[model samples]
Target: MEEDIQISFLNKLSCFFLIVLFLGCDTPGKILIKNETQDDVIYRYYKKETDENVAIDTVSIHVPALSEKYIILGFGSLWTESQLKSYIQNLQKIELIKATDTIVLKDKVEIYNYFKKRIKGVHKDEIEIIIK
Candidate 1:
């Protein structure tokens, strides 16, 4: 009985380690590199606030080498429409930039990216979107 119990415990330990290793291989985010000939830099910014649980907003920017040109901007989940609209408008007004491209907004539970000239401030609770 003692030997059987020890074998069972060892099996569970090995399975747990394998599960962790598998998960560590994949991360949560939307960023990919293309055109290896060019030296481009990718950046990710995260801002968070919490009431009870933590809420986070992430921004990803890809700057091309030897130029002021950027290719991509990503917005992770937790960013609402009101927040995005306000952020875009503020960037246009303050930074003197406009949206030269469009981002596809889809209803999926995966990490999402929305390109922008800049990201602005957060939205107030009064402008919340009701899902009901």
Candidate 2:
């Protein structure tokens, strides 16, 4: 009877651990940048923290004329999901610098809504920037 009780307790503990593992498997929010352009583009990603715009990463990739690339940006533990989404939506400047030309994308209401929707799910958010 005591052996049976010990086995039952171990089973319960295993179940609990499995549940925790499944719950923790939820993917964090991310940013995906797809470059569909003729020339090689240099992209910079930034986040606003403590009232300052901090550059997170910079990548220069030669995306073919029709192909796409994904850039994943994860959220920090310091802020909630909503706060992180808001910060990304409110970003005033996102630049695609190519050669001597620089294109600036401003965050309008529609743009913010688009980003909010993209980053809403557990999947990574995606944005396609086309350079002419």
Q: Per-prediction count of colliding residue pairs?
A: 1, 0
Those runs of model 2 whose alpha carbons end farther than 4 Å from true positions after fitting are 1-24, 51-72, 75-85, 98-102, 108-111, 117-132
Which residue pairs clash within candidate 1?
A: 75-114
- Alpha-carbon error at 21 in model 1, in Å? 0.7
- Residue-by-residue lDDT tens digits, candidate 2, 17-38: 9999776665444454555566
lDDT of 1 by residue, 1-112 (tens): 9999999999999999999977654423222223232354444444444443755555555555433433223333223555445434322111111134222333222122
Best by lDDT: 2
Compute the lDDT for candidate 1: 0.38
TM-score of candidate 2 versus the correct structure, residues matched by position: 0.45
Cα lDDT listed for each candidate: 0.38, 0.55
